[model samples]
Target: MSKALDANNRRWSTLVWGSIPVVLLAGALTVDHIPGTDVRLTVPYAAEGPGPTFDTLGEVDGEPVVDIQGADTEDTGGHLNMTTVSVRTNMTLGQALGRWIATDDTIVPVEQILPPDLGEDEVREFNQQAFVASEASATVAAMHYLDRPTTVVVHDVVEGAASAGILHPADRITAIAGKEVSTPSEVQDAVRAKTPGESIEITVERDNEPHHETVELGENPHEAGQAMLGILMTSEPAGGVTVNYNLNDIGGPSAGMMFSLAVIDKLTPGALTGGTFVAGTGTIDDDGEVGPIGGITHKIRGAEEAGAELFLAPAGNCDAVKRVHTDHMTVAKVDNLPEAVAAMEDFAAGRDVPTC
Candidate 1:
């Protein structure tokens, strides 16, 4: 009996020892944190090319007051490329570990990429809205450069909002309550004057024709006693040159600067890119002011990979730009559209240009 009991005890000890390796291996491989690196995962780059990208503006009503030298030029010059980043979600333990160890990829915290209380759908919708706003801003910047008349229009309708079903995206909000509203604030104020659940007549220009929409005001979720229209808008020329963006599935405002450059290139004579590969990312406004965007380092990688010799970065992003190591790519810090254009010109002319 003593021998049998001793043998059982030895077997128990052996089983406990054998399980240790499996437990350690499991712990090593377990995904304790969401894994994704900012480094290895490069955001896709799109240029003004054959597919969905910047294209030449079609015929408009009035003749050009200012003569555009290369207004009719075809795809002779190289394209101004825009950079984008892919948002990763639900990464596995192994994938996260791989990214963490990878040299090229930088680990991005889960919170930064995915904010709390926000779902993937919400993020996508926000991106889509941003994309629309970028298009409007690009159009405005292009028209502003060309010295043309423009108007502000509704670019998107927020989901689950008052105007979601009533007002469509890209519907030009011409007037509110019989008053001409040119800016987004004006539209907001017009809506604010009315009570929630009240119906107001809004005039919009769709497809170059006047179409009126009667939209009911929704209560502002954040503010009490405030009316909401649940739409996103940007300033656009009332009768300006039409610039069409063919980017499909790619969302976000980071492409605004590139889009504006593409428009300028198509409208003016000579290559805006200076016959060289140019890549950039920034948010462009109607005033031609370039705004900072996220993921500058990743974008630099993308630009470098695309064989871009020159990179146009927003002035606000210079601090971040300084930290990123982009080999053989000269990064120029630009504050506005004019500066970007000048940088390209200087590059083409072989003159000393500003660097970040």
Candidate 2:
């Protein structure tokens, strides 16, 4: 009898604990799925909460129209401030069901369905996962596109960097620190031989005329005991190999996807834009593959608010993204730009978008 009672008690405890989530889930689903109801809830920890999508007051094609600003723009909608319901549902399913079941309609809401606003604990976790996934995809694409580093010949020196003026983007450095160079490796070796605060003369050719400029090196960047010039050099694509990339004003590691796409698009023919205002956030590789991004749901909400007709997301985020989808926008899950482009074309043609 005692053993039976103990087993019964354990069963009751399990039933009580398990029912909490089930009941909450059911209630939330019932409310969210119903019609003539607004599922407006506050996301406390969200970076930018729901608001207008317009980032800047600008014009495209010289026509007066709103333009989306760079990713760094502060025009993002309002962020969730606290862990509370900012507004109540117009007709919550939970409340409606309870009203139908009894004379007195009293519905008890879930205790912790959503996280705290700006919840660093949870947001940090999500960022960590997102960055890891993005890094892996970026690594793969870079390896494919930048397979072998090539050298570019400096032809002109309009500005003398370290000597007097700026170095033009197209100018090539033939030799550094008085060393003969034909490849990028040789230039690097010559530069590496000099110590910080030392002056090095870089030889270059402009219009078949050779010239030299002396520059003082700066302290090591990021790591100690190393030397740097604090400037990036570029050259023509050698060996018939080319690279394409997309860049934005927001300079961070997160722009990997845009950079990759920009590079690939330059290498390929035609423009990616079909004359539509489509904004996206994701990491791209050198191979022109699209990868997952962080804060996708928030991004989706932002896209919808911006009047975007379609959204392209990573395949891995499809399931989670689907759960948060609204009828106001279309989300297309894809592993690369090719798939994403196809989806965009379909959406343009008024075809039904496939869900993840």
Give me the overall lDDT of model 1: 0.74
TM-score, candidate number 1:
0.66
Q: Which stretches of candidate 2 lie over 4 Å from their true place?
A: 1-251, 258-271, 352-354
Candidate 1 lDDT, tens digit per residue, 1-356?
Answer: 69999999999999999999988756545544424634333222211111122222322234321223413534436647777665454655545565556645556666676566777789778888888788878877877786766676777789999888888888888899999876677888888899999999999888888998898889998999788898988786564545556665778888888877777776667788778888888998877899999888878887787787888999999998999887788899999999999999999888878987
Query: Per-residue alpha-carbon lDDT of model 2 for 279-311, expressed as tens digits?
Result: 445666534566665456666766776666666
TM-score of each: 0.66, 0.36
TM for candidate 2 is 0.36
Question: How far out, in Å, is residue 353 in model 1?
Answer: 1.4
Prediction-by-prediction clash tally: 14, 18
Error of 1 at 19 (Å): 10
